[model samples]
Target chain A: MSRAALLVLADGRFPAGGHAHSGGAEAAVKAGRVSGAGSLEEFCRGRLHTAGLVAASLAAGAVLGLDPVELDGAADARTPSPALRTAARRLGRQLMRAARATWPSAELDALAREFPKGAHQPVVLGLAARAAGLGAEDAAYCAVYESVSGPASATVRLLSLDPFDATGVLARLAPDLDRVAHQAVEAARCALVNGVDALPAASAPLLEISAEVHAAWPVRLFAS
Target chain B: MHLDHNHTHDGPPAVSADAHRPDGRRRALRIGLGGPVGSGKTATVAALCKALRDELSLAVVTNDIYTREDAEFLLREAVLPPERITAVETGACPHTAIRDDISANLEAVEDLEDEIGPLDLILVESGGDNLTATFSKGLVDAQIFVIDVAGGDDIPRKGGPGVTTADLLVVNKTDLAPHVGSDLGRMAADAKAQRAELPVVFQSLRAEGGVKDVAEWVRGQLAAWVA
Candidate 1:
């Protein structure tokens, strides 16, 4: 596997539409849940263990050659909020377009045709990783890292939190990110044996609720 | 190299800048309008739509910094049918949405085509931002940077990417030039110095010939595109 491809996929500037969504951070910031770096760290930690773990597992499974369509459905079943589901699919579709252009494959094209709208972002992420010749662990790491990094950078923009402090938040979460990626790969292996239900169904009810609220905002910065 | 292995499938192409769709029909000419906050980007888009809607099948995609205000404005004005306009939330970084990560805008434009197809033009309007902001070539075929005399006549003299590289630079609200203490002659001279041979239009939407020169430039671009 080309290890360099992982960097390409993980880049914040990959142009897959992640810049427009805050991963519920907008709602969290408005609710005063993530005011400064300390609270931002707490919010990211909670997110890392729950939503991060689930997304990582989904991405890892996709890298393991699991059926992406079924994986997409599994993603839908795990996400409770209707608004979040819509965001996931939209982001997934955007990611699919970027991935196909970056690392075109018959598998990706087939998946794109199947879900023209989208198929959950983690599923597309894993397929993109696979197409780039990356492994399940790499895909998991990318997914896990993204779950926190998105919120951290967005919080910097949302609250004008010090960029250094936000980077420190991400740095402090490195061990947690490693653990989540490891756990995700393990769950993905279990799914490879026993189907996608073996993957983690970790949910953040607050994130779901806040996402719904954020979606309804007549005036807001991020899309979700 | 990316397209090598995927030759057989008949699916939507991954890249969005292609001149032709999968069915072999020419796609719409996408023009971007970008400028500083309150420089009249939205007004230009609305005026362009109103001027060209009769002759062209046109649509618009708006990148609003915080709210759907620009899209709401176009809708409120009834310049185009509601279905022909779409808004993209920029997450407080309008420049990023148009230049760095244009996926959302691309999706918006493609969705417009998929839904209301065979369009002749699509105007992608960026949220009011700094002078550094310009549309990516991947996003728009041509770009217009709008700066009004009210903002400052020295903007062209400032010579950022928007002023120097845009296909067309528009000095808007010319009627307010005297009121705002801006020198239109010096502004034009500085713009010519900065842009060399590129086109610049001094327009006043409140004036008798509103958006005429811009509409004509767009028509010329469309003619070249369809040629």
Candidate 2:
């Protein structure tokens, strides 16, 4: 697997439709749980362990040769919010376009043909990682990093928090990020043997509830 | 290697400029309008829609920063049916949606085509942003950068990507030029210096047939696209 290819897949500028989304950070910030850089760090950490962990595991599972359709079902079960489901599938379709253009795998094409609307984004990320000459771990790392990075970047805009502070928060969370990515790969490996049911179903009720509220807002910065 | 072999060229494309629905029909020509806040990007889209709706099938996609104001305004004016106009939220960075990361905008255009398709043209209007903001070639067949005379005549002299690289530059609100102390001729000359042979249209939507030149330019683009 090429390290350069992994970087290309993980780059925020991957043109996979990530910028328009704040993950669940916009809702958290509006709820005042993420006002300043310090709070932003706490919010990212929470998301990293829960949504991030689940997403990473799903991605790693995809790389482990799990059925994309089944993994998509698992992803939907893990994500409770309908609005977030829409965002995930929407982003998945966008990533499909970019990944297909970059890697052009039959697997990616089949997925696109199957879910013309979209599958969950993490599932596509794993497929993209495989197509990019990357490993399950690379897919896991991409999912975990994006889970926190989306919110940290959005908080910088939402709260006008110091940009350096946001960067610092991400830097501070690197150790935790590493731990979650490692755990996700392990979970994926286990799920490969034990079945997709073994994948973690961690949920953040607040993120789910807040996502629905944010979706109903007449106006918002991020799409979800 | 397995990775290299995994991606055979025989499969269908993931992304391409020659976009097609699964059925193999040609998609509508996408044109983007970008400019600074209140420079009349939305107004240009409205006028273009009005001018071409009778002649050609048309739809619109608007990227609004933190609001649906642009889409709402167009819908309120009844330029096109509400179904034909879609708004994409830009997350406060309008340029990012049009230039750096165009996934959302692409989705909006494709969705419009899917819901009300076989259309001839789709106008993508960008939220108000700086001079550096421009549309990606992947997103639009051509782009028009709109700047009003009231913004300043020297804006043309301070050429950025939008001024030089845009397929066309529109100097809007010609009626406001005299009142705002702007020199239209000097602006046009500066525009020429910045863009060697590219076209620039001075327009005032308030005037009758104000968007005529731009509409004609768009017709030429659609002709080329079909040809």
**lDDT for each residue of candidate 1 in A27-142, tens digit (9 for 90 to 100):** 99999898999999999999999999999999999999899999999999999999999999999998998898899898998898899888899999999999999999999999
Error of 1 at B49 (Å): 1.1
Candidate 2: residue B218 Cα off by (Å): 0.8
By summed lDDT, which 10 consecutive residues of candidate 1 chain A come out lowest?
A: A109-118
| DockQ in order | 0.74, 0.55
RMSD of each: 2.7, 4.2
Per-residue error (Å), model 2, residue B225: 1.3
- Against the unseen true structure, what C-alpha lDDT does each candidate score? 0.92, 0.90
TM-score of chain A of each: 0.99, 0.99
True contacts kept of 1: 0.79
lDDT of 2 by residue, A65-175 (tens): 999999999999888899999999999998999999899798998998788889899999999999998999999999999999999888888888889999999999999
Once fitted onto the true fold, the runs of candidate 2 whose alpha carbons sit more than 4 angstroms away are B1-14
Give a tens-digit lDDT track for model 1, residues B96-138.
9999988889889888988997899999999999999999998
